[model samples]
Target: MKILYILCLLISTQVFSQDDSFAKEYFKNGDYEKALFEYKKLYAQSSSNINYISQIITTHQQLEQYAEAETFITELIQRVDYPSFLVELGYNYQLKKDMAQANLSYRKALASIDENPNNVFAVARSFQNHTLLNEAIIAYEKAMVLKPDYNFNLQLAQLYGEQGNIEKMFISYIDFAEANPLSLGNIKRAINDFISEKSENENNVIFRKIILKKLQQEPNLLWNELLSWLFIQQKDFKKAFAQEKAIFNRQPESLLRIEELAAIASNENELDIAKEIYIFITQTAQDANTLLEAHYNLMQLETKQSSKENYQAIDATYQELFKKFGTFSQTLKLQIAYAHFLAFYKNDTKKATSFLEKTLELPLSELQKAEVKLELGDILVLQEKFNDALIYYTQIQRNLKNSTISQEARYKVAKASYYKGDFKWAESQLKILKSSTSQLIANDALDLKLLITDNKYEDSLQTALKLYAKADLLSFQNRNDESIALLSKILNEHKTEPIIPQALFKQAQLYEDKIQFDKAEANYEAIIANYRDGILVDDAYFKLAELYENKLNQPEKAKALYEKIIFDHADSIYFVDARKKYRALRGDAIN
Candidate 1:
């Protein structure tokens, strides 16, 4: 209880001491009324200061005790007439909102200021306080002329802007920009305001042209971005691209913004904008992976119809891209995309073969290799290389193990045998594959099985000979496309029949005939890759090698297929052509 009493007493003393400190600060700063109030609180206890009595008189005048303060000043005037003190007496009238007397007080102050303009700002502040803005402006102008570096012009400009004097406001912003052109936030806001106002008001619209000229005079990165959007709004893509070059050059971080803009353009099929953006991505992005997604998006957006010509250019583009990205092989999407465009658009069999072959040799997992081998086998079969097609299918069969693709490989093996004229063996394979787990394969196997079964009761040999005769007539007339189409229809119409592979082989040969090497290579390789011990393996290999060597300009490339054929199929029909070409390309001294 005694300790509590002492703590309370100490806290009370501290609070009173703090109040006295604040009272002294107010009194010294000349806010006498507030100081007087604080001092009176202490004076009630034991105050006896003559200065405090003098302060009470000053505080009365400041508090509008003009009658009381007049008597107090009368005695002080007899002792000394301070000019600054006289100004205070006059300013007190103004502080009481008596404008007329305040003006009188300011005039008396100026009576001494003719000898000195140093107090002009103080007089201006008096006029400003009195709501005499015009008079204040005059005084400020005079003071500025005398003391040119007055920091108050910034405040004056702000006042003018608030008063809606736009011309002066515009000039102020221009001055600010001149002093600090790098203050982008302020500059952009000011310019945007100017643009909005001018665009709405016809007479003010001239400001747009003026500001545009200024923008062109200094083309920084922000200016570049702004101008590019401006040009785009004006429907000028070429100019937009030209302007955007500065953005990447000056501010590389802006490339991400460019991507977002380009994506918007691409969605609208603004091909020109999308193209520029895609190019910028490859150039400005820190890593190839950064733009790889955009590349894939572009690949998806690319259609076969409208952008066919663009699709055709994918090979050369990918080759250049490979050079840029160091052929890292991790970008499997690039491989898939390149293969798609090459096989469908370029019709380059050897290129497709080489591409898929290299893809097979990549550090891909078993699943990826299996997937790519399926593509490879299809390409081989399209080129009339049945045996090579069988090799791919058989590998998938062994490698894929329990995979659904492995089940589908069984049907492909049947197709390979049928193409090689092994109808009996092919039909036997198709019978088991008829109940394939895959609906498409099952349907195909069933069709081929049915066609063979249906024909067995009739003159099967005669009907097939007729189909072959009709296909040959189309080929003879150089209607290779029509023949290929016809053979495809036959395969589709009689899918499960033993004659499907014969149709497949004929269609593959027709693709080759029409120089549709990609499709032809697919059919040929499918045959060789899927039907390992099938009959057409020899013919498919020889023809595929011939296409590679002659049409595809691939001596080294053709050698692989030919060597495999000669090594694997000694009793095959095209052994002669395969052997001769192999020797010629390899410079093999054949005994």
Candidate 2:
């Protein structure tokens, strides 16, 4: 009997092996129906290889045969002692979008309280995907409870964070980090982005503080990155520099960190620290990138307090940097910084022009050329050479029609024209720029346009009054050119309004500001001679005489006008000042 049983067992093994090979071939040919036929033949013979059972469900799923698939998976779940195999049935149901069955399978698999991490994770993922979040949370909890050292806490933390359940994320991070502190990188990165974004929301402050405390414990995680970012946000750049220095110390081989430290130090007004960092980076890096960045920062540091010193320091740095690293494209930044320092701060516009033009021979892109041209235009405008400035500014406009830089260039061109006393042309440029897309630029253009737009009629007295008032407002804002341009606009529109005398007086004063003594004297004298009985006549006669004598050296004409104001207008307020200045100009020494 024993020999017969052994022979039957051997025969059964051979038959099952044959059925398995047939099933494999059928599955390989994409014939799920034939594959199912062979697999079921083995299954009917009481051969329950878990893989065969799982493949049966998978084949049925592929054939959209869900009802038959559920029966096999359900029985397999009941009969299989392998927790992983049981957990897998849950996933198969989920694949069919049968959430109800999937949920039932996952819960059933976990019902034994078998503390297996892989099974717990599988169930958790299924619950998470099926929107059974409470069940997913329980699975994650069970995962931790089964094996506290498995270290999937970061995953759980992120899951909570994704749902905006920040308090849960915080608590999970704390507990997870306490369990495995060395494994805090993902949690640290998540907390970094999360707290950084929500740092300003009042309700999230305490939550951020919790993360910050964790960050404090793990100083190696992102101490410098977070510190530097925090200081930069607060505009406390000096502190950012200090933090960057610590980062450089921790990673001394990092030339990039050294360069960043130097730049941040300079922005913070710690020029000495900036210089130290720059010198160190340049020595170690010894390349064009580090050297040029350091040299540029040195120039900026010197320029912070003194322009003459700024010029000397920038010139020295540029010559040395060019000698060392001029072959690199990065050297252009050094050259550009030095040019700006020379033009605006040092007021050595001739040197600024020279430095900027030298870059013309270098390989510069259209955008770079546009930037240089804009700076050069600013230099020319500062020198009171508006025509040359217009050429540079217009070149940029022709290249980029509707860019923000083009809008800026147009604005500068109009500003230069205003300074040159070309009120009409300046006003035209402003009208277009007032419609610019950039808000701040548009607002400035609108203000300047309003300054010139006061004279709506070029030949109306009311327009002249409005223009004069606009000039006064410009003077209040310290916009001297716009003020003077509006004054000229008023003069063109002056048609004997009740305010004509005041407009003429303002024009004389603005011309004086321009140091156009001859024009100032002419405007003052015109007011006094043409509007003798005008309210500003007494004041105009006094001013006209002062300009003629003090600026033009015509004491005799000054004496004659002062005498007219005192003798002809006895009740005028200028009687005292006019008589007093008249005596002084004639060498009377009246105090």
Candidate 3:
């Protein structure tokens, strides 16, 4: 008997669900009378369902039967003590241009919240749904006052933001974040819509002042952290560093935040401040790993700024660090960096190769070993020992298959083949890597594969293609001047070839690195003017826009170029960044 009863219940539920779906479909298809009939039938079967009641009311309104909708809502209010029904009734009155009755009904709903604080949620939500901003705000505020434990700051903040009450919105958001600390990140993201990269932006200034006042009054680390975030957004790393230091002093448990700040500054090209922060870490960090990382970052910054005359000093510093912290797996990155410096910067490939060979003897994990071998392969490639480089790269692929490092090794193998002028083999390897797990590797592979397939058949000897590969190899070897000159040769001699645009783009990058802005501008302009239909035109537009904005101080020109990428090359990889730059240059208030 019980089993039979369960089966019947299941059938009943399935039938009801089907009925509800049919009602919704009717309503969606604009067959309102049929929808109303179905809804009434469903409501008759389950009169206690608020969804059915609400849908009945809404369908009446949709049919423009305002009097009928008001009557239905009034009957619901009489049947139950539900306060939100008053909002429906009031809205029905408002639709009929009876503002006086609508206001009276709304007042009754607000009064219900006074009798029961929990009604505030429903009442405020109803008001907000009806676009009654002031009533909703009043409802929330009254609830919080009557029930001190109640928290509606987040809702209130959003409502205030919608009303354009910026100060109140910010204060409420901060209050909500203070009560729910875990929501701080979400609050920052919400607040980010109103601020810009400029420190002096009005909203940014307002946010900063609020944080400063909070800091002065309460002296909380949360305020400090927020201040640091704001300063970082403004690219005021120095002020951000100050805030980070204050937090570190009080906490003293971690330098992670400070280390992250240094990296951010470094990425922003605030190298001096990055060095300052890293030096502080090296002095105060107790953990061996942290100290080593700080030293490594500091050394990297110094090396980036050092001239050939200062190379010996940088080498001495590297030796000192290795001696201070014994050569082991812990310092693997620094060791690899030192090897790269030796081979690439000091032009001592023999010593760099021998050093890495010794370092390979260290106890290391598979990934760590791959890291070392990858650098070794790069050094071999630098030495033009392409076959030898392939051996190391192949070892990594065999040892760590399906990993990012393995994919990187495969890309290296393809690149080495490309450099050796084995276009057929290179194309095969690159085709395999087009779907690699690593996006960077996939992009590189696709680019190299396209380069080979595009220009290889243009000449019987593949002369222009081979020359392009040689220029790319010179770029990898850090021979920028020679790379630029070779690309110039390709541009002059291979003008009619499809590879001319690629050469021009490549040379423009080298020119930028050499700080020859005018030359870079000319190269990019050539690609833009002559190769408007080429794949690299978008790349040219974006790079030249950045050059004009940052190097040439021609914001209008940059804006126009970015507009080209925005409107013409929607699928280009640079489209998103170009649009952002274009908006920032145009002073569009970012949201």
Candidate 4:
């Protein structure tokens, strides 16, 4: 009797497996009618299987047998009292274009949410699958109200976004973020989708208004932070600083956010506001590191805007900071920034070199000393002391072997050699750096290596390559006008050489920096017109398009150029950014 019972159970299990396999294969192949038949057979054998029942209903709907699907789904609802079945029934009627029945069924689905709030996900998901977003929203809201523990604001925000309701979407996202404060990063990502370059955009305006209303109702620190983020997005650093101040006052936290804002403002050339913010940080910061950073940034900002007339004052400011901060290992960055300012801006490499030497005498670790030596090497290069610069760079490389700084030092050694007209040695160093662990170093090494090798063989004595290297060094020394003149010389003197496009591209960048837009545009256009087959052609296209769009305010020409990049340079590195800009300019709905 026991053996007979075991044989019967094995037979039953085998039959069920066969039916499941048959249904899955047909469904995978889109043979919905056959899949429905097999699933129904399986359901008849095991009426308690929810998976089998759901598959049967979905397959019937896929075959456009809506009445059959509705009948099965209604029966399933009666047998199990599950709310999601009602959603399926409504979707069936919806597919059949029976609006009255669909409305009634959807209302029934929402009404069932109170019976079992935990089933809300299934009900809402079913409606979403059928594109009945409003019905989905109602189901989720009803469930959340019935059970206060049920949090579905994240889903609601996504659904609202799909419905083009930016205000409601942001509100739902804010609610979710407030409930789950650890989800701030996720919330910011969702909100950024609706933002744009134009602060006056409808969605942007709506989002700002919603946050402002929230702030007015109950001035939460989160609201202040969000406002700071929005202002940063709008590139209004002054307003962002105000919001940061509000946050700091309300919470009395560290000045990290203010420091970051100051750095960004300085990077964007909002110097006056950045200076004010840095001053505020210098006053407010409690940590020694933060205070030192604030002071260093202030001096760096001053140096960035310094001229020969104001160099003395800027030098004095650095000296004062150093006097107050002292030359400990912790103050290495400040020391390096001061040295760079002296060498590059004040034209006092003698003092800069001496200052760095004294800094190296401090109690320092190997890496800290390596950093000082790297800056010292840069100063030496500025003073045309190529051999001395190479000595420092090589020492760092030998000491900190296999480190990121070592890779940087190796690249600088190659650059110094290139500037000294030692093409063979520079190319050799760059060859080994092509596979460097640090991507920035690798890229710079490859670029300089290419500039040397590509142009060195063009002339027997490498005259053009040497001149280009000198121009690069001059540019590095902040002699932009002289660099531009030298590049222009190469353009006129080496007409047939392959280096002309590169020289034109470099000179165009310098002109752009000088705010000589017409000359820059002419140079970019010359590259496009004359060297369409060159490697820099795509770069020319992108830069020219940016100039027309931003500086010249010619949208049509910019659009045409972007279109060219999209079609012709599909495999270029700038493809993704070009596509994004093109879509934004074409007025596509970004989110």
Among these predictions, the greatest lDDT belongs to 3
TM-score of 2: 0.45
Pairs in steric clash, model 4: none
Cα error of candidate 2 at position 216, Å: 11
Question: Would you list the rank order by lDDT, best first?
Answer: 3, 4, 2, 1
What would you estimate as the lDDT of candidate 1?
0.62
Model 3 ranges with Cα > 4 A deviation: 1-38
Ranking by TM-score: 3, 4, 2, 1
Which whole-number lDDT from 0 to 100 does residue 71 have in model 4? 77
lDDT of 2 by residue, 1-591 (tens): 423533554566555665588898999999999999888877777444544665787789789887787677667556545454445566677777877877676777676445446667546665565455666677777767777666666667767766767778767775676676665565555554444222244324545466467667776535455556555543455566677777766777657755766666666556776776666665666465565666676666666545454457657766776786663456667777778876776667788899789886678888778888888887776666778889999999999889999999999888777665566787899999888999999988986676566444544433453456557646634466888777777566656445556667776787886788887788887886788876667778877777776678888988898889778988876887786666555544112
- Candidate 1, residue 51: how far the Cα is off, in Å: 20
Best by TM-score: 3
What lDDT tens digits, residue by residue, belong to model 1 across residues 1-591?
423533543555555554477677887787877887876666455223333434555667656677666555455444443233344556566566777976676566555445556666456655555455555555555666666665355445444555666555555555455555566455555434333211234213344344466677875454465556545543456666777776667766646666766776676557766776777676567766767866755555553223456654655667776676544456776776677556545667688778887887778888778777777776666665779989999999898875778877777777666655556766887887766678788777886666556455445463563454356445633457777777777666665555555676778777874668888777778777776565566767777787787678877879998898788887776676677667556653211
Q: Can you give the TM-score per candidate against the true fold?
A: 0.32, 0.45, 0.92, 0.89
Candidate 3 residue-wise lDDT, 322-377, digit = tens? 99998999999999999999999999999999999999999999999999999999
Sequence-dependent TM-score of model 3: 0.92
